[model samples]
Target: MIDRRDALAGIVAMFGATLFAPIARAASVQVAVIDTGPPSSAVFTAGQRALVSALSERVIPTTDTPGAIAAEVPQFIEKLLADWARPEDKEPILAGLGAIETRSRRDYKVAAADATPEQQDALLTLAMNDQLPGGADFFDKFRQLVITGYYTSEIGITQEREYLPVPGKYDGAYPYARVTKVFSS
Candidate 1:
């Protein structure tokens, strides 16, 4: 007879195997995860999309790992805003994006996307430092979304770290000394 505790443990052990599982192709995996695709009614304009894309790329630049843009962070964010964010939450974010552009234009004579990467970096840092009005709130939230979206994406989970499909049993005694980089889910 399977007791509740035993059943729960079995479920957890089974689910845990997926954490180290090899991912499929990037596009296929992305399609599987976001079958609905980026919001059909994406809120941002072409220019706004460009701004967020550039900003997301800056937030998680291409390292050995692919950056936020490669992880499709901006699209995920647009979907979240379209489907989940309330007016109060969404409005401030949009306003902040516009503000960044305004500041960029004023300081650099270009939009945020048009500004050089270094200038974008400086502007983002300045905004985070409370130099821009209400920037702290916007930057913090936007940064978190970009981060979460990136890590949750398939490319981040597979190529960024080791992937082994059907990772077999979860070893309670797996040695930490054997780890080079922390495995991604």
Candidate 2:
């Protein structure tokens, strides 16, 4: 009894409804999206993982202090990108990685990892200085994330920075020398 157009519309609507049913149900249930993927595997895309690894190394190299890699900074970035980053932010992140890779390949004829430590440092410095095109903000974001990940790690909080759990119990005023000594030691 229905016209051809009406019948086609009904079929299409049914197909769409069936296709999106699970998604609609999941949204209604409010599932908590968590990153349970293996950390050692390719967590981020190749470009993102490369950038994260490089930034972590640059921020906290293994030679001097325990660096971002040791503190699982790549894992942090992976989790952050999967759960927290906006869709709009992904372009810049990708663009930044591409730019860096291009620069490294063109300038040094090697990938970032294959480059010398000095070259790595120079690339990072240039990125930090906003010298690279199309990815300065991305570099800045990566640097900030690496630093944040490192400083918030168990090693960083207990070892590198002053982390006081209970500040209320301490005296309101203290001498600079005493405070500095307590914090430093």
| Whole-model lDDT per candidate | 0.81, 0.70
Give TM-scores for every candidate, taking all chains together and pairing residue i with residue i: 0.74, 0.69
lDDT of 1: 0.81
Measured by C-alpha RMSD in angstroms, how accurate is candidate 2? 14.3
Error of 2 at 150 (Å): 1.4
Clashing pairs in 1: 22-164, 22-165
Worst 10 residues of 2 by lDDT: 13-22
Name the 10 consecutive residues with the lowest summed lDDT in model 1.
12-21
Query: Clash pairs of candidate 2?
Result: none
RMSD value for candidate 1: 10.4
**Cα lDDT for residue 53, model 1?**
94
